[model samples]
Target chain A: MSSILKKFLMALTGLALVGFLIAHLGGNLYLFLGRDHFDGYAKKLEEMGPLLILAEIVLAGLFLTHLFMALKLTGENQTARGAQGYADNSKNQSTPASRWMWITGLFVMMFLVVHIKMFKFGEREKPITAKGEEIIKAFNGEEAAKQFARESGEHGSLYGLVQKEFKRPAVVGFYVVLMLVLGAHLSHGIASAFQSLGVLRPGWLQCLKPWCVALAWLIALGFALLPVCTFFGIGIN
Target chain B: MNFTLNVWRQKNANDQGRFETYQAKNISPEASFLEMLDVVNNELEAEGKEPIAFDHDCREGICGACGMMISGRAHGPRAATTTCQLYMRNFQDGETLTLEPWRAKAFPLVRDLVVDRSAFDRIIQAGGFISVNTGNAADANALPVPKDNAELAMDAAACIGCGACVAACKNASAMLFVSAKVSHLALLPQGDAERVRRTLNMVKTMDEAGFGNCSNTGACEAECPKSISISNIARLNREYARAKLLS
Candidate 1:
């Protein structure tokens, strides 16, 4: 495919990921609504059954496409530099985020794996609560999973899983660091994606860059606040 | 004024380059950077030593021919000035400066401080001209070109095909150069007929020549001798996308 096409795909996937982050942050903010609301939100997702699975599949595809395109583009860029190393590469004018995008992206991917593992496998050593194990044992089939979902009292317990996950200082610290890196990446990325897709005017970028930086910080702070607040028992049960 | 120069020297494209230090003693502070090299070359030639080879056509900056990384900045510490226009007075009396050729895969080293930038020529040849026959000169304002477009086109047209943007770019991208060529033609009424094809062909040629993709890093704009703005690059991207969408 053409390089421009690859760039377009990268930008398209990036914009989609940014959209996903907004939805995710909004959903996670339901934690502030107290345990029942957050737990019901989680239960509602499982209740969607095949639809939720399909959406996750689409999200995974977007993530993979974004990753592959980035690797291919970065490889081409490095090769275009040829076999010489600059004696004073410091002179190249660029933002630190733009220069370090690949490294930050790889770290974000690593964090995603750990994050999904937290949800799917119940937080490594947190010891799934007896209520969680009872639900799992009680619901062996698809019909029972739905029946379990209808019983809101029984389903009100998954928030315990989130509470345990975020209450750990190590998990919270690592999550905060990754969120900061994500912010750095997005600060450059939001405007950069538009420029790459050829939709952004250069004159608009100056006005947009500050806004992109602010949005990045907002997303980072929003995601980070949960674990930080939870770890300090500020609104923790 | 005297200066210490660390000049890069390589026998050919296949050979590894190394820095060769020379003392340019008793040099005039008024001499241009290239002229200082000329005096140093004279001394080397008199001693039966091979003078360091470098590229130069017009000692004036407009030709876009004479260029080298002086002290890691394109065309020396003076911003917006070509190596040929850079004067020795810009350097401190006893300061050391390093000189090297444009280091992009698209512009391979010829020797010493010279690089073959014909990759740019091929990109120009790809679509830098309008093919329509006007046969003879029309009345001065026959085309009725818009003033702002003419000015923007002039800004892009000011590019002299220098590879400084590529040299300064960490990715060694040629986006600024290709964009200049595309925008210059695409902005003109005379070029309207082939605007779409021209953008596609020139950009394809640039990529085929192994130039890197623009990361929107702004390095090219920072170090361009002509002070070519990256807005032209934005235009190129827009044109390239428009072409693909229509195609």
Candidate 2:
């Protein structure tokens, strides 16, 4: 395929991933509304059944395609530069975020693996409340938490798990750092994706960079806020 | 003014290049960057040593022949200025300067501070022209071109094929140069006949030459001596997509 086509695919998949991030951030922000609202939202997603699985499949496809194109293009770009490099190379107008995209992208991918492991497949302990402890004791411990959750029309104790995870200084610190890396990736990726797909014009060019950066940081700040607030007991009871 | 020069020196393509320091003494601050190099070469010749080899033509900066990375910048520290037009007055006395050639897989080093940029000529040969019958020039008002398009075409046409865009690019991508050539012709009525074929063929040729893909860093536009806008790159992408869809 032509280099432009490769970049076009990269841009398409990248933009799709950005859409997923926005939606995911919006849903995750329901945590601030307390345990019932957050767990109910999770339950509603699970209630989609096969449709939720299909959505997950599509999201996975987009992320894999984006990763594939990034690796292929990055390898080609490195080879195209030849073996001998400059003695003292310096950037003229590129930002740090733009120049270090590959590194930031790889870091985000690694962060995603840890994130999914922690949230999706990890243990969800019962909430630390008087009624919650009594229910756990009466239902015969941690395994009954899911049964109780289903009976009560919720998605287990996911809110409690999130609160427990964020209460750890190390976990909160890791989440915040990864969110910043994600922001750096998006700062370049958003504007670059538009340029790659030929969606920008000369008139929009002046405002595009700043707007992209602002939007990227805003999303990062939104995600980062959840962990920080949870760590400080702002949204926890 | 006097300066220290650490210039890349290589006998040939097979030679392992290295930076060699030379002292430029009693240089005039009014001299252009190339003229200062000429003074150093004269001194080397007087001392019965090999002088530095570089490229230059029409030192007025229009010919696109003279270029080198001066202290890590494509054309010294001046914006929209080529090496031949960059005067020594911009630098302080006793400053140390480093010079290197444009390095890319498509641009093989030929000698000291000179690389073969014929890859650009090949890209041009692919489709950088309009096909018309051999006859007298057409009347200026015969074909009406919109004022905005004409100005935009002129902006793209200002590109001098200097290869500075590649030098400035972190990936050594030539998207800016190729886009300028593509845009200058594609924006005109005379180029409408073969626009699809031209965009496809030129892009294919550019890829086959081993140039990297554009990452939209804007460094090319920032360091372009002609100040060629990256808007040309966006236009090139649109043209390429349109051609792909049409065919």
lDDT of 2 at A60: 92
Please state the error at residue B169 of candidate 2 in Å: 0.7
The best candidate in terms of DockQ: 2
TM-score of 2: 0.94
lDDT string, candidate 2, A72-97, tens digits: 98999999889988887764678888
Number of the top TM-score candidate: 2
Candidate 2 lDDT by residue in tens digits, B1-247: 9999999999999998899999999989899999999999999999999999999999999999999998888988899999999999999999999999998999999999999999999999999998765267778777899988899899999999999999888888999999999999888888888889999999999999999989998989999999999888888999999999998
Q: What is the lDDT of residue A80 in candidate 1?
A: 98
TM-score of each: 0.91, 0.94
Judged by DockQ cut-offs, the docking class of candidate 1 is medium
